[model samples]
Target: MAPRNDTAEPVAAPAGAAGLAAAAASHVTVTLAPLTEQLATYLAPADVQRVREAYKFSDAAHLGQFRTSGEPYITHPIAVTEICAGWKLDTDALMAALLHDVMEDQGVPKQELAERFGGEVAELVDGLSKLDRLDFATKTQQQAESFRKMLLAMARDVRVILIKLADRLHNMRTLDAVAPEKRRRVARETLDIYSPIAHRLGLNVLYREFQDRCFEAMYPNRYRTLQKAVLSARGNRREVVGRITEAVRAALPAAGIDADVYGREKTLFGIYTKMVEQKKSFSEVLDIYGFRVVVHSQPECYLTLGTLHQLYRPVPGKFKDYIAIPKINGYQSLHTTLVGPYGTPVEFQVRTRDMHHVAESGVASHWLYKSSDVSLNDLQKRTHQWLQSLLDIQRQTGDSGEFLEHVKVDLFPDAVYVFTPRGQIISLPRGATPIDFAYFIHTDIGNQAVAAKVNNEFVPLRTELKSGDTVDIVTSPASRPNAQWLNFVRSGRARSEIRHYLRTVKYAESVAFGERLLRQELTVLGLELPESTDIAWNKLARATGANSREEILADIGLGKRLAAVVARRFSPGADVVATTAAAVDEFVAARSAPILIQGNEGQSVQLAPCCSPIPGDTLMAFIRLGQGLVVHTTDCPVARRMRAREPERWVNVGWDENPATHFNARVDVIARNERGVLGRIAAEVTAADSNITHVTMQDDAASSVTLHFTLQVDGREHLARVFRFLRRIPQVQRIVRIKG
Candidate 1:
């Protein structure tokens, strides 16, 4: 399990005024009064009383536990509850916040909490608890599983993550008492996982706080130094800031704009990140001055932008209109950089009051303020879609570690927006390819994607998309995801779906291949293949500890178990089958035919790269343990060496008479070192109807060069034609097919 905060405790009955005074006098700190007062602002009296009861129950459950800071354990839950109250969350969320750790730390049952506080509160608390009872090979695996659990729960109820983030925030604020090494670890995790999540959800307030707190915990010295520098810079920049603020304030009202304008500085962590990423000194980072203009309506946001531009020349190409196309997290603002006093760059963000609230609180705004605004509804819908994608990714991914990896990949904040063929806006992470876009539309589209058109022009599926590009995916039912797609796909959904398809396909292929190999071996043993309903098959499965017959075959197909050894399990008299080598050889010669190879055998059969074996080549296969069959040319040096070492692994394999797909063949050309010589060779190869997949050239002498090319061909006949064509070039001296 992940490291838990030592700060949770159960609740007892709420301390009334006199009870609070008595507890305070006894030095038992009680924080229920302030929490109740905060809740009273938004919640009804009955709801507030319920929250108080939950706090009391939690306090009692946590009786004598203490945090690393030596505070009563109940203080942590109250602090978390206070954060939730500030968001004006519902009474049940507050109750869950107060009792989130009881089930994990106090050993309190979820059933008991449900009976007392209702199922919603109990479920919320359950989501917050880690899976501590399960044993894992490593802390990372355990933490991943626990995170998977919590995130799935959060997907079902957004309130769960809200409360969880509050819990983490409070814990981070009190991290000083933790041991130094552990502090650093927790800080790193918060920065990598929790902070991005907070940002992805549009909780900029929590996100910034998480970053700065983590920065402080992980690098106290750098944080302190940077803090001092910021403070010093603040004094020096005050006059310029005042001038810009006064100029903006004075200009806005004259333009009939009702707005609240204020100057603000960037966060310490934000500044530090800029300096590190851009490789600049503090003084070189000139755009630290930030201003916000809050207006009454969305139209005024643009009007305010024009007013700001009129007051100060807007920096060219530094303006972004996020209002028209809100960010994926539902953040909407018009951002512009302008030349302030003395040409110093000053950044300004203009948004309406509602946008500002949503910008600051993110998804929390959906609950914090009850409104019928379309933007808020859109925000909620977008958040739900993202959460639903998480569940989709988890279902396709088998391991918790892999699921966490996909989620992290999906948490990226910087995105490029594109349009579908139907004009629907789709946002993906920056550097995302067409494959990611396809998957973003639907898994089926992604699985069968064959080609793509970006802005009416055909492009490779791996092309990185830019904002405003309209993309159309061309899919075919015959097309399937290639393993190569995993290299460039940016979306988590695409990666997981492709992997799931490949795994399923590979297992099926393995089972079929295993059956063929086992049948061949049984024929050589003078025994017939067993039927599915045969008793011998069941007995064999039991002896191999296999769950089913297919599993046993899959093992053999994957080379996990030798087919020769398994063939004896079906024979009534293994001694008779092995009685004479001469008899076995004669039986093998009469009945065992070589396995036929099709180019599209998927993962069950692989053609060796050492010697690109195409159809018409004499090929031998080696069954590598747990890796299936690897096909190699008969005379390949590597194959000869492997045969010498493990002759038993060698198998007879022959190419199918009519292979459907093209195969890769390597060719070497010795040509004159002329500028147009390489181009001529390429043209000749193309003229021969072969595609050059890869090429490399190196100078072999003063006037000659050696060129190596990998070409896609139907078979050796097509490859020979390519060689024959290349040999006609005036610069070409000698041509040879590379066999090894």
Candidate 2:
């Protein structure tokens, strides 16, 4: 059983205030002395001394500082430390928790902390400190960067995130004292980011608290109403809960299965979410109470489950054997829902005592190095694997906002269990594809994935995998990841790897294009392009603020720098400058023969979605800052508007005579609002050999309707073919292509 810390109680408040009073009552604030005593229960005496020293330093550093509750700010860190101590974290983690706010609030130097404490403790403190003072383009960007930095730190040492989560938890608990607007913002962020992270880490206790607190802060009246409703229901359902508990206890002991049987209620926030998501009233939300059976061993867990199922009729499709294939967070249990007495649905979880500890405490259950077990080691290895993947993602992803997006997508993994050819169970997120499965098995396999077989039948790599499907991935040494995989692959690791590979390939292509453009211009100058003698190009690189000549040329290819300016700088004299000027005009000349498009340039070339320009279209290119060349149709209204405002940024571009891939085109269809209008339009497109990617309807007009479609076509000719087919339809009033 987990020990309770009495000092970690919420602030006292007057009675009859309802939710606000309840929040204030549940808010925890701990003092230094009791926190130290709690640490002494698990930590060594020497470690306890270190924690005391950290408390004194943090307390002194935060002197004269108070929170919105008018309490000394030192109380916050102590409370955070107490939370960590409850997890049985190491002394370094406890010390770091105590001093987490000192550097941010008191401007203490990290080097000084390192010298006073150990380097690891100081590093953890530095990781917990926020980057609020730094400049950013926006607050969202700043937040993303802050999370990115913290996640990277957490990747290095998991203790950083554990402490950070505890800190956030305490803040959420005491959020009622803050201003209303800031309080709501904090609560929403806690729900969006931190709560999901807590869930991912398997910190169920903190996860539920964070969710319930955020729900209360975000919607106080609703929370209060729901709280009352739950209270009333608990009153009405008391006898049922009692009877069920009694039945389970009696059955377990009578069956000679020694177990700890208890009942647990779902979190109020969880109940509220179900009500909103399922469109159910509070009364309709059955199965509010669940029972847990803790046994001595794994076999006993199964036996207890069998006993419970025999006691009550098992609800079909409500049984899940997580013990056979544990959750990603190392949570193991047998979950089942049963139709109990009075026809109420009762949920039950059967696990061992050790499994229960991990289910509640998660990674923190194994934080003590001296008390390691196989279960704890498995938890540590799994956590370290995820953390190491974060480091890999950080290396592949440079943009903080994008990194956070990927991490967020990965956080809430509703997993599906699949099987390899050899029957090894592999768990992946729901809606994951064979590509994700391939990558989960190995990066090399993902990169080399040529084809896949599901249940001995060949399937597309984009096929969404279902549970219990046997998947086999075929690989070839010559194969590499296709950029299109980014559109369908669901796992963060696979997405990151595909993007990293594409970026690398793009850079290499840019270098080659830069070399060709520069060499052609030099040839026009009646001068030979110098080799990488380092002396000539190195001087030019220095003049251009680029690290090397290659980078300068790549910038020219990427349209970051002007080739004209580079040529002028590279010219030896005025005569060469005039010659370079002549070559610039030649380079600017619009021609279909010289400019080629193979449709394989990853990021360097992008077909504008506004016009959906395809092959054999009269195309022009506009270079946006930081984004490479954006190809647009010549007559596109959006392109015309942009060109009218910024004519200098436009350049000559043309499609290849034989382009390698199809393009997306937007088509508008106005037809009589009949039963089969959409079907006829789809059939017409299909007859014209086009694929409709997306469809949307404008309004519910009685006689006429307008439908918009994004379709794949070979070129402008193919689009015209589809349009002609649509115009021939009898019910079609009008059909036009959308350029913007």
Candidate 3:
């Protein structure tokens, strides 16, 4: 934090001291000299050469182009690479980091990098490239696309994120050079996209750094104000830290536990966000600093926690034992927020050496143990478990934006370290409800999820789960997950599963709808749907992304996807490949029932008095998507007349096979005012076993009554029987089915 010394500093402008200082101030240079020594001390000789080559190549490529702040652009790459180098990334990753932006900003082609550096390095660069033709029209769209890119790359290899983080870090550090609006934009993006990702990956240090940097740019005035206050308050804070640090160290050693104690300051963004949320000032925000006690082993971590609790009273409901229940992001620690000096809540985190390493370096250190300090063999073994979970969530997510959203919520969860009744730890995202925990156990359990028992007490599914509470996800095979649980699910896996379930249900419905329409059309065409027809339709649908023949019929019949356009074109019936027109037509013709109606009351079909369908209607039949059938008289124009134009698409749709939903059709009757007419009409309809939902009567030298009636029927024939029976009422003048 100290400025450069006399030797490095300019006594007099020794040739180009002003330019160098300006360059230093501009890209806001950090001392890369410190990182170079650190890397040489860590990397093997062979790997060192590759890392060196990347530095050389990138430095040369970015030679003349200065950063907006005026530092040679080479410095930006070096600084970013320096951060990645600290993460001990492989030589290929380090190389990619060095050249990450060359493809996007410079005219450097991806091919040249592939030939020169190898495909791995080139592919990494290409993955990091910005959308080539992005119009940047809306910030929201641009952000969405950027998030999509990062996620796709992160899915393949996490190293891309590490490089991207480092790049963003450097950019944020020098954000002052950008326009004020641009600064805010970058800050917002960092907060929204990158910070959460780092947290999800368990890169706690980087996550906090990203937030603080962004906070500084976004709220410089507040940052400066708080910083000055913090400087003045340092004396009091140091006294509290010293008192707690001494007490914890003394208690741990006495309890036969050897540990290293380190103090942690809450990040600026963390403090600010809490302040804004709680409507509190900096002084009122207690527990703003914490202490980490790194022990020698897992058992000692617990013993040390006990010893610390004995020294200071533990705060109620402020403890989390993550050592027993590791976070989804692979973070493990024992956390206890205690009432320390002056009754202020002071948080303490206890961890083993390895847990501390994973807590800091995350998966990176787990892959290769360069440090003489810590072993991450446990996290290394569970790497596949984490990766599999990520892959599972991704597989179920249907879209990129959705996938990214779930990952952010679930992966980098503000965790609830819950326990099974058996004390098995389950870390769920913060705000996860009990139902989310249900699906986490098994899909069938979730699908049949009904009620839950948290600690043997029946709790609502929306109950927010807490850390350390033993939860038993009580499920019955008969119990079912509610569509409403989607509002509370916090896990990516759970959320994705819920969405998938809903989508599946919707698709099934769409298929059923399509099926009903198809059956009606075939009936209208005097074609019987063959036994083989359903299967063939489904197969054709699968090929064309349709679910069934009905969906195809519905699509074609409704003119949504165009039925005739996809009619196998009906030209020569020749599809030499799969699904020829001849095969389909033969299938359709052979199944022909050639629907014939035995006329009961009228020569032509009329709109039923109930569930009215009028002329010029664009209507379609609904098969519950998955359940029973209902036909909507499409737009207000009604259906019967439009049926004449394409009689083939209308099916011999009777009434419900088994009635589930009630249908009410409106009847508007006009007559010269007659008092007994309405009563007589109602009696006749009631005799037909039809019930009216409502009856409205009006007078204007004539009477009009609009009655919505409900009736049970097998098909149109049954409906015709009701109509003919009701027609016998003498008081009824003219009855017409209401359209729409």
> Which candidate number would show the highest lDDT if scored against the true structure?
1
- The C-alpha lDDT values of all candidates are 0.84, 0.79, 0.64
Per-residue accuracy of model 1 over 433-539 as CA lDDT, tens digit each: 99999999888999899889999988889999999999999897857788999999988888899999988988998888888778877887788888888876667
RMSD (Cα, Å) for all candidates, in order, is: 5.1, 9.3, 12.7
Per-candidate TM vs. native? 0.86, 0.75, 0.67
Pairs that clash in candidate 2: 10-27
| Ten residues in sequence with the least summed lDDT for candidate 1 | 575-584
Ranked by TM-score, the better of candidates 1 and 3 is 1
Residue 582 error for model 2, in Å?
14
Q: Give the TM-score of candidate 1.
A: 0.86
**Tens-place lDDT digits, model 3, residues 594-642:** 2222212111222344244322233343212222223445443444555
Give the Å error, residue 446, model 2. Answer: 2.9
Q: Write candidate 2's Cα lDDT for 1-740 as tens digits.
A: 00111112223343465444345335545456787778778778899999899989997887645565656567888888888888888888989999997887688999999999989999999998878555788878878888998989999888888998998888887887777787788888888888877877878888889999999988999999999988898889999999988888899888889999888999889999999999999999998999888998899988888888899999999999988888888889999999988999999999998888888878877764336543677777778888888888889899988888778767874777899999988878778899999988998999889889999988889999998899999897756788888888777888988888878866776776666556655555555677888476776666556787778667756767545445544567522222222233343542223345555554666778788888877888886644457888899999999999977677777665668555788888888888888988899999999988678898648899889888989887888899989988899999888887
